[model samples]
Target: MKRNVILLATAIAAIGSCNEADTSKTPPTNDSSQVKTSTADNKYVNQPLVTHIYTADPSAHVFNGRIYVYPSHDTATGTPENDNGDHFNMMDYHILSMDSVGGKVTDHGVALHIKDIPWAGRQLWAPDAAFANGTYYLYFPVKDKKDVFHIGVATSKTPEGPFKAEKEPIKGSYSIDPCVFKDDNGSYYMYFGGIWGGQLQRWNNNKYDSAAQLRKPAELAILPRVAKLSADMKSFAEPVKEIKIIDSTGKLYKEKDNDKRFFEASWMHKYNGKYYFSYSTGDTHNINYAIGDSPYGPFTYKGLLLAPVEGWTNHHSIIEKDGKWYLFYHDIQLSGKTHLRNVKVTELKYNADGSIQTVHSQK
Candidate 1:
């Protein structure tokens, strides 16, 4: 929250499966070695699989029967004693993948770096990716030189890629996590928000407008947003829609301290025809989820999917692989500090009623 506060004072800050070996289009990258195949006793592996590097904001996707993860790369702040600062300092993104569920992960190296982005500053925070039109699109948020957070995109011919970033950010888009979901009908929707007062906003033409900014009845801060993406995938096709995680039966979300209202990391996936909207709470330590009938939801907040971990921050994504569901998240266990986090995955269990079971990761 401290880093987020500074981000605000500085001015605004800030998945679906497919068959194996999709042959409809060419892969984004030609690096065949990036695809990892495992012949282990079990198809599954333990949590904290990638230990050598610290990664956060894991966005997991299934492509060509493999799982590709896009995460923010975390490095020491260059200050040893206070390595664990409240602020987030990320500079690059790595695309990690595995052949299947329970397989070994192949670090695809630096897919996108801050130095390469012409408009980005040092703080390259959360990112998410999607495969469409035979291309892999990476959506990320970074603070501009003016210290305002803006969302931008990078593109690669393959999932494991040396992505080429655009010179500018998504028109009219601001704030943090940019999650793009392509529905069954081939329509694309984007969900994004975070940090300072979640006044949800939408992309209009080349700028953004929010209920709070418009003086609408919507809560000015701390609610997530959903909007339809343009056919070309560069901007919003329509006005952005706001999402309220908590119901109106109770007191206003901001008034309820322990409520599971949307805080930051907004993720959406469809299971059994039910749209699951999951996110990390305002506390940053816990992860929670809700379900709706459609993409943009009037969701009913179910409950916590993950409790607090060693790190003060937690962001995640969920996907089904080989008939099993898994939660991709991060923790500070490796560095023994909050700033440097490592990626981890745990089996996600769903009860008979289609509700997600609480995840228990090894400390």
Candidate 2:
């Protein structure tokens, strides 16, 4: 955590300010959580940013002059694998950080543990971080006693914690993968939800329908959600709205269009005055984006951001530092097992036309 918090806010406020600008990925397409990743492709080996422990579903941000990463701490619990993602038995979170590009990454020991969260039952998945009112807020996903997933918030004076967990989860948060984006106007909007094991398919008519299956293949694919956050960055400031990702023809992506659909992991960034809503197409193994005029969008699909790396799942975050942009993500490169993963980073670029140049390796 840097003392000059205002500069950090300026960097984020600059996201849509200087600009306008910005997926977990899903499980394998074969309807199984087990994925065999190729290591020989060496070109896709973008090298882990930290190798001391396993981490995934990276949510990266700049705080002061440093970068703080909030990611799901992957653990090998040996819980039998299934479509419900039981194999991903992550129990806690450790914050990873760096001082600069190509700099030393520091693992800021346990920030929040499952044992400290009173409402949590099992699984602490992907998380995102934000700075407001001189306090750093960590937004995360965890399952409650009912086995239903919900998002929760924790707070710390520093970017990395020892964070204090709230006694309850956010009232309107359901499903998983929460991304909190701050607008140039100083408003904070949260984008979240995922299907398959991530459970976006389990909610019906805004209520939990444990038996609900995937939406019809011919109908529009499941959409991620967006809602403004309270000024305190603790609860929803408005009703949650669905975020639609349509194609060039204004046609909404259908369930069968798995290649470009929202699977999990929601992130928003502003560059050159455009809002880029990017996400992972679970099971498809790639990260993609859609561009819109506003934060809440019926965005038109652009194209791939990161190609399928050597894994069954993928999650990432993007930020501009020192006038250059970088993508922070994860893969099973360290253990070669789906449940264990490592965080990695690589330079990301945008074309003259404002479309992101698909990245396959570190620049």
Candidate 3:
């Protein structure tokens, strides 16, 4: 099997400088085998919910008694040939579906492509999907230029589209990694932001022209926030709340001089009555998680979910299937660069106290 060792020095440097305060609750010394066996004796071994390969950063949801996975196409190897100039082409969305996971992904094909969208020219990235009422909403990021990125939404009556893009992009101050969550009280909210120099922004109107008109630029640093949406889920309501979800005082592997917090890939889900926010940190390859009593604020660091294993930086998604949780993430198995990263999946477990057990790559 091929292995990646190019980023060894950089990975060490990043890991070495990571603040222990971020992962102090569950120290690095926790035994991996012990955590796995603590829940049950390999209860996940024969389950049909686990996937073997060819999928990564999976965002899963149940629609019509089937599990549909929407992940970015691993078209580029982060190599020079496929990476014309930038790291990725961002052209297509790969869709896989099964009557149930671990079974067979009966319908596997390119469900949506970049050219399919009206305004999108190129650069499609991570996408998240959810079904509400009678419509399926898919949220994703696309780059219009070198630094100009934006999030766009598409809706369809079925999980696999024929999805039609809105009249314009979902305008925000900064755009990347858009995730949607609906609360128990019947409200919808979206959270997203990554890289440096930008902050998370929430919109009262689900559809807006641009981040500039959505809110002031100064409001971006609030890690994650919640907004109220109209019942149709196509527009937002008045009186939005910009809640601070992540506290990045001394959590990064390297705290560079940047005003906006470096935390990206903000995902919010409520499990057992508490909100759990999972995100990527430590230069985008080191995955970390946090928990909060509410979706909006004061999340406490839970620690590293999975690190760069076999020379790969980890970017991930957490999904629950058949009464079990799985971590869907990406790793550069072919090279140290970002474009070559391939998607991977593994089982996830939670402790009795609601803390997630650390995740590792299966050898």
TM-score of each: 0.79, 0.87, 0.69
Stretches off by above 4 angstroms in model 3 are: 1-56, 77-85, 145-147, 196-226, 238-262, 282-284, 310-313, 334-337
Displacement of residue 137 (Cα, Å) in model 2 is: 0.5
Name the runs in model 1 displaced over 4 angstroms. Answer: 1-46, 79-86, 197-221, 248-252
* Candidate 1 weakest lDDT stretch, 10 residues: 5-14
Off by over 4 Å in 2: 1-45
Clash totals for all candidate models: 11, 15, 12
Q: What TM-score does prediction 3 earn?
A: 0.69
lDDT of 1 at 236: 81
RMSD of each: 9.7, 9.7, 12.0
Q: Give the TM-score of candidate 1.
A: 0.79
Quality of model 1 by C-alpha lDDT: 0.69
> What is the C-alpha RMSD, rounded to one decimal, of candidate 3?
12.0
lDDT of each: 0.69, 0.79, 0.53
Q: Which tens-of-lDDT digit does each residue in 243-288 have in candidate 1?
A: 7665546333552343366668888899899888988765545678
- Residue 20 displacement in candidate 1 (angstroms): 23
Q: Per-residue lDDT for 52-165 in model 3, tens only?
A: 222345566667877677776655434353212244555677566666434444434456677877767666777888778889988777765444566777888889665677
Clashes of 2: 15
